[model samples]
Target: MRFIYRLVFALSLTLGVSAQSFAQGLIRDAEAEIMMERYADPLIQAAGLNPDSVDLYLIGDMEFNAFVTGGQNIFMHTGAIVIADQPIEIKGVLAHEIGHIDGAHLARFGDASRGALATMAMTVGLGLAAALAGEGGAGAAIMASGSQFATLDMLRYTRAQEAAADQAAANYLEATGQSGRGLVATFERFRYQEVMSRQRQMEYFRSHPLSADRIGALRRSVDNSPYVDVTDTPEEVDELRRVQAKIIGFMVPPAQTFNRYPESDTSVPARYARSVAYFKRGDLDHARAELQTLMDEEPENPFFRELEGQMLYESGFIAESIAPYERAVELMPDSPLLRIGLATSLIAAGSTEQLESAKAHLRFALTEEPENSLGWYQLSIAHQALGEQALAELATAERAFSVGNNVEAYQFATRAHESLESGTPAWVRAAELKAVAQPSPDEIREWNRNQRQRQPLAPSRGLR
Candidate 1:
């Protein structure tokens, strides 16, 4: 398996200092964003939140999970994407996490806690408590000791918050015209897995604590909803699911995934999945062939196009990769990943003529998603290519800090600072932006506070 350990969790807290100080990997593929936006738009609209304001992250892990830290950022485990049979399931999971943010559960906890130390204590204690709660065979012994911590109450409260988030998810799905069935279905699927293993059962029971009655309640709510017919499914959702599958599946061992769906139509994605396997196995020719076949079948599939372009680029076919990447941008104009690939390929091909076009594409991509670190990075390179050192420095600084490349960020920030004519607004802004590259004590506190804002509300103690 092509595993990526320590995939940094999404931290979006508004601390006295910026979490931007930490390095967060950039997964800014045009195809990934396009997929994310498809599901994100509907969920945000349903929850009455601005789609543009929310940032979605795909964590490189095999665990079937999704969660939001104190920040409002939504995180999806790559495993969650690879394992899901359909795109709606991923949406169901994201919508549920969004429910936690919209419900302000974390904010409520912060308000209830007396201070930062107490909040940290509660956070750590709650994690331990949840883990202990999952120790089914040893539940009695664990709980006996677990109750000693003050956060036990808080832990129970967190479970309640999860339930409330569940209820809110149902409402969001129904309001948005998507079926609450997906949510219920996902829950039931987890519930089944919980039943199969004492460990999983304990984990779900501790964190979720849903009973038959609760599941039935959700079912009833879905059954009674009047807005069942209201939702318009975006074609992008399916495409995103396929893209998710391809990317994630490619990351995993082909045997594990192909074993489950040996001859399914989903095999196309599985083949793409195996292509990654081939690449990892150092069979570049086979990998290229597999991706090429996929591209041939779905010529307009930008994700496949991007992959083909990347394969060609990596295989010393820089010139050959350019056309596919250009076509990829034509297919998804707003994709930063494709633009980055195109720019990188252009630079590799040493085409000064394409430099202007590449810069234009990067700029357009940055405008669409300012936090796209790769776009800014590519923009800097493109600027450097055009003999614009000052602009390159500025773009590089912004790119560095936004995605948590503190060292490079600091270097770029300093370069940008030195390149500027003193006392100009550009210099001042660059300096301010650079400050965020390395988070200080105050920034951490502010980030913690921001994270608390997305937390779900604690369930009433008297309810269960």
Candidate 2:
């Protein structure tokens, strides 16, 4: 069944919170991307999907739900990471979402409703207007409204479509040599919670609408499958558990999290979680000790090593922070967050020799993840340190403007103007680019027109 996905915010609860508030922090994005490549990529490939073409996004919400937005993006709430039991469970969830994509569910829905199309158009229109006006809050509100509209549209999907996705997900799981049991297990977890008090039931269940028949169907599929190894290896399972614990440790109260999962050798994740709790509670000494102990136990684990560096950096031990970050980069060279951390610390330490390396690292990261505004900003800073003032200003202006960094953009533009020779071609081009970044009547009109062109046509209804 084709359906539009939507997210309904409690206005009273989120009135003052803008959508930008939901953007994944730099560190968080790095962690998420790593996990996606490690686990999600394989499952997506098994499902006969292109991993590179699919955009995975982290939604800054604590709800245990994930859904597709339009036909292009997969939005996963942070809560899903915290609650999932294993990497396969996450893979399972993503596989199901991919099932929707592979089944052309979004296109089917897009072809079904005019109202949804108009909603999408208006949503994009409002977003462009907000961007032009420098009203990030208003833009977020409109984007949220658009998601809600899509969800409502999806709620109308036929049982057959849902069943088809379920079956396809199971097939993909089998083909990938992963147990389809994770799907059943995930559904069972949500199903068990369905009987809880209204307030206790997560938004995942509210929208997913679990039924006895769904559970029955999953069980039947699992029972009929020939694969026997439904469980992950101890190491793989531990990583999943640790990832969840770390996320929850960061999000939930320290006392409550520790109380739920005490520190133990077998439960290294719980220890890590407690370490984070200590860090958050401002007990830096204890936090440092906890992380140090973990590092001693697992000297080669890149995640723990990275956490140690993070602890040091956050606690203001700038000089002491470089070693662990450097070690982590050696262990996981492709990690952008680790590179960002290393770059930031190098800049703070005023290491002129490392500036070029920092620039190279950030430039590489931008190539892989162009939407990372922070990388671009850091790249600009690196260029500045290298005495490339004009280049630095342009990169900074481009990044700051793309992500609504108006004040920074304006400042960079002014600096670029002063740095260039008065009558040269470079100076004129810099001024023009600066104008493009800044607010102006002509720019606003152009932005509006561009938005309209990008808007999707209304979906046709009554096609079930």
Candidate 3:
């Protein structure tokens, strides 16, 4: 249970189950995903892709990059989102990534990767062996040739993909009644990077390979489009500011955030950033004060109340945190994230009635977000506290399975089967998990690939 408690805390702070859970460098926050979907769904719809089939993930790294892997899954870096000044800018990036998906670029990349690796291995291997055998000049020449071949192949393919994506992104913008100006501006910002050596350029530039000609092509597209001069709605602009503030507050040092978002700026985004900065720095009094001011300004804002709850709950105010967490959930009943926060607070309170309430919240949250490992973990604790031993084991098994810990999942599922009656839903579910206790890597990959195809895109909590 103590480990469960820590897992919940880590989930809150890092938007991940554990450090190891993010081996793919993903940050699975409900808010971030929602923001991305809001920007992407329109492009996807315009591109005639099924929204349900396209899964979006936010990369944890600060580098500016976006790419689509095998399926319709799009990965965008948090740093890119944070750096963009408007939702439209991110929308542009999303549009380009979707272009790659629509064009089957990932499959092409896979094919190219196979051949490139083989070529590199043969030439580089020989080159290294030659050098190691005292043929330094011959080795250098051989290695250079191999490296050049691989690099040129990659650069050519990526450059072509980038050009195609740029054109496709512009078309999506035109079709969706959105401006390509954001896309043009975003790329223009990176135009200077073209002068740098490819190795010295940012990952985004390296992967997307930009050039003056590419910029000119994009500019021409933007200039010809009817929506070129259009700007983001007031609501969209406000959301972008708040999202950026939140990212900066959480990602940067507290002192730096406070300095950037000084008290003189009483705007919602400024206050939000300062509140999170205060919380992160253990300045509980300041954090609570800022959150209270925010709540006073917008009593119905679920995110404001959610932050208040997070600050209280994370600062060890378990009993007091419940009220705000509960309020946030009430305001946004459909938000699984808020529900999980409330459930964890209730569980931490450790009272019989609180445990019951916690279970209700956790069950509701899990119903909407079954893959949420933290939700499953907390639900298990709640079930155990309520003496639902069978259900508790099942929940623990689910949490383990969600986090890729098959051994723990298997053990817990087996124990769950012993307590539940035969043929019951809980018993049957446990049996299913028990059967796939040690899923092969390929099986996991296939299941993940299929799950994206099956699930509907969850609506992001609207910008407030």
Local distance difference test, per candidate?
A: 0.60, 0.64, 0.73
> Considering every candidate listed, which one attains the maximal lDDT?
3
List the lowest-lDDT window of 10 residues for candidate 3: 1-10
TM-score of 1: 0.70
Question: Which has the higher TM-score value, candidate number 1 or candidate number 2?
Answer: 2
lDDT of 1 by residue, 210-317 (tens): 566667877788778786434336564456545755654444555664564354544575677667656555577877887777888888777677776766776788
> lDDT: which is higher, 2 or 3?
3
Off by over 4 Å in 3: 1-10, 13-25, 110-157, 436-464
Q: Report the lDDT of model 2 for residue 115.
A: 58
Q: How close to the true structure is residue 407 of candidate 3, measured as C-alpha lDDT?
A: 61
Question: Which has the better lDDT: candidate 1, or candidate 3?
Answer: 3
* Candidate 1 segments exceeding 4 Å error: 1-26, 110-159, 192-206, 227-241, 257-267, 385-387, 404-464
The residue pairs that clash in candidate 3, if any, are none
Residue 90 lDDT (model 3): 92
**Each candidate: RMSD:** 12.0, 9.2, 12.2
Per-model TM values vs. the true structure: 0.70, 0.74, 0.80
